[model samples]
Target: MEAGPRVLIVEDDARLAAMLRELLQSEGYEVSLAPDGQRGLHLGLTESFDVAVLDRGLPVIDGLDLLTKLRERGVLVPVLVLSALGNAADRVEGLDRGAEDYLAKPFDIDELLARLRVLRRRPASTVPVIRFAGGTLDAANRVVTRDDGGRLALSERETALLERLARRPNQVFSREDLLENVFADADDPGIVDTYVHHLRRKLGRELIETVRGIGYRMGAAP
Candidate 1:
């Protein structure tokens, strides 16, 4: 099995920082959090990471300055800049400063993960393959194959959802948790149920165990 990619996230907002940490950790990435740009700069310069996620506004040292200093020190790991400054010029500036990608605040978690995946340039071999009672989920190709060899192609959303569940078999995920990590607030909470149903229809009704009044997990009925 491939090791989890290491990630450094620098954001001053306590709530947002914690949320980002939890979400990334759930995806099996080894994550470290820095609440200020100074600490972030220190980590970026001293330690090695597959990628870094940074916020534009930071205390002690501005995020842009941190990025600038990191580059000045020859740190070349990909950086995904996250900020509330969503203007075109703002994005251009971040890119100019050497961010590999830029994401606006109030962003969807799914998009963030997708961007990080791209930035990491994860090799095909490192993609996780998940196996359960009835089938295998080939994440590299986003296909789920049953023991009999039948395969079900999945949409990106479905693939991410399945991947998360497969990573921790039997671990339940609540609707709110799924909504926060798998979709944006623009998406209705009911969408979680919709996708769960779709997975059931394709993977078998019993493949995903639903916890009444709680959430869903990976498994089958007895």
Candidate 2:
């Protein structure tokens, strides 16, 4: 991969996912993992990934179904199917279903890396910074502000976290979810709650809506 491929791995096996994460990270690839196909598909659609490692068998949504949807929606990112089905027919079937490549279980590390390098050869992936609710977020700058010309400082972590939430208004993300997905570490569960509290105080009371007992969600500025 030229600039390093940002890969998304969709696997239900937690241990396998961890091993993949470690291995991919060691290879200098930016990695994101989803425990099920639903989250994986959602991330793939909303976020830009250079390559997606999709398990043929998934719980929430089948891997084939996700590849189909992505292809139907015109998302042409390379997908390398991962499965335990080693038969030649199975591999052929998966590739025919829109997979760029199919790798069976117990594959060698060198081969997996080789396949990822091949996936990255297709193209570079980038995400556009979204604007809504009368404010512009400098995604590259990791900053946000009101359109009224008022300036409020936000730390890098807070700004990045806020940007993720602000991307999809009315999307409720639990504290644990934010901790795991939004932040680099789930070190502080209370940190998300604290960030929400601080963000509300800064952006305005109604900028984010709290769904009692569940999590926090973003909304239009009042």
Candidate 3:
């Protein structure tokens, strides 16, 4: 017989995780459980799954952070976020970070299963590798390859920020713009400045240019 669709469950609550694993397995899903966000991240980055069910309050890495990292590296597995914080803002934030669906704690088991079915049926998305004068930003792999053949690995946020700038090379993005689009969860807009510094240090100062009193833009390749 063919194997069932693969499912990953990342929840810190051991009993809950085990219950989910058992329930999903009975439903014909091949389930893998991670008791912490760190382990979840490893499994998510290295494994292939039809869908993922992630708890928002995971240890080591928050669910949103894990979701962001998954998307940055081009993991297209549909994710359903499970959180006790089920307010409108929380749901919106989860969706914004790349979750295909959100289910609050105390959720109906039937609803959760229904949502997973929908996510499993959805097609995976593809992100194109961005080319700039200095190098290529492989958003899928989270790597920057210089024209001279040197490659630099980027963290999750770095890849997202660089991909945003590279996608629109001619347009200037204000710090607020980057904050809203790239760092939506960040309270301080200065985080943009910090990541910009990081990228410049690794890729070269000329790779990105700061517009006076405005924001920043993709510069001519170094």
Which candidate leads in lDDT? 3
- Which pairs of residues clash in candidate 3, taking residues 3 or more apart in a chain or in different chains? none
Q: Can you tell me which runs of candidate 2 are displaced by over 4 Å?
A: 1-3, 123-222
Writing each residue's lDDT as its tens digit, candidate 3 over 22-79 gives: 8999999999999887788778877899999999999988989989867755678999
Q: Candidates' lDDT values, in order?
A: 0.82, 0.78, 0.89
What lDDT tens digits, residue by residue, belong to model 1 across residues 182-217? 543225788998988888888888878889989999
> Top model by TM-score, which number?
3
Q: Residue 112 CA error for candidate 2 (Å)?
A: 0.3
Ranking by TM-score: 3, 2, 1
CA RMSD of each candidate after superposition: 16.0, 8.2, 7.0
Off by over 4 Å in 3: 134-222
What TM-score, over all chains together, does every model reach? Answer: 0.54, 0.55, 0.66
Give the candidate order by descending lDDT.
Answer: 3, 1, 2
Error of 2 at 209 (Å): 37
How does candidate 2 fare on TM-score? 0.55
TM-score of structure candidate 1: 0.54
